[model samples]
Target: MSRNKGGRPPKNEGQKIKQAHLRLTEDQHKKLMQLEDQIGLNRTDLFIKRVLENQDFIITKDVLIQLAKVGAEMGKVGSNINQLAKHANTIIKNHQLPPEIVAQYNDLLGLHLVQERELYKVLRQMYRVMKN
Candidate 1:
């Protein structure tokens, strides 16, 4: 802790200062100004308060427990997918394959790729929202 001129510990003594300029759309600017008028706080103070609120702080030990639970569910889904691919390979091996089956598999893989790309787009949008 850093001491002030009177030798008392200073609040937020070691905190880093932020110096980034943010751009807002005209509509967003108008809305934020309206909020500022109603709340009696300037844009800077309101923005800082919102940024602080958006920070993810650990509330309890159970937070990690919840994350682990979700991770396990994802693992199960991955394992199931792997098992499905293995079963499909086995079927391909056991059959005198027609071209249609191969085409269907290729189409399914393409669909998965498209879905993955869309998912990434959505996730990027969510991250942008969080940052803003």
Candidate 2:
């Protein structure tokens, strides 16, 4: 029986209300109830607000694809480093090379491996930010 400022009944009341049932884990339900209390609204009102304001939600597909590509490149880099390490290990096992050469190869492998790891960390951080 709510009336608008113009003394007319609200147009929306006559509209049909749709009901839906959802299941959630106990922890999730508790969190939802806490969010409702924090927002001064029930869960239904919160869902409505979320639907209305979903423009703020981010689902960056392109960024995700780019991250996948970066991951693939990182994997290739890792594979290359792995092959190099295996080759060096084989040489060490064969003992065909001088100690100084083996030491140099080990140093080079360590540098490349560390650089690859750092690059992977950066890529992971970028992916997290984009996906969040």
Candidate 3:
């Protein structure tokens, strides 16, 4: 009988739950932002990858471009789902919908899965780079 309370899920007891806040100089912030935008990682993740995990690796522009494409495709998929839901609601006001709704849902789900696969491949490539 697991139930969510509608907020953030509880964290494990032993997890790394601490947070840090830092202020950097203008030049330092600029350099960090450049790496963040180019590598598709935020400051915390970049620090973890470089300092904590010690997985220093160079990421080319191609990887970032591929990630951007995956992200754009995901946005389009979400828009399509929202439009389908709106149309279905308009047609099924106080009535049962037909089976095509399930088909539409499945199609959207399949599209999202394909995009996830692409994202996974990019992550795998990054992992391979890290292992070297």
**lDDT tens digits by residue: candidate 2, 1-132:** 995567756568647478867899999999988766654656665675566455233334555577689778868877886887788789878977677876887787789778778977876676554453
Show the colliding residue pairs in model 3.
none
Error of 2 at 27 (Å): 50
Model 3 clashing-pair count: 0
For each candidate, give its TM-score against the true structure: 0.40, 0.38, 0.40
* Candidate 1 residue pairs that clash: none
Candidate number achieving the greatest lDDT relative to the actual structure: 3
Let me know the TM-score candidate 3 reaches against the reference structure. Answer: 0.40
RMSD of 1: 10.3
- Winner by lDDT between candidate 3 and candidate 2: 3
Residue 88, model 2: Cα distance from true site in angstroms: 2.8
Expressed as tens digits, the lDDT of each residue in 1-132 for candidate 3 is 996669877898968689888799999999989888887777877887788777767675766687689778878878887897888888789788887876888787888789778877878987687565
Model 2 scores a TM of: 0.38
lDDT of each: 0.65, 0.69, 0.79
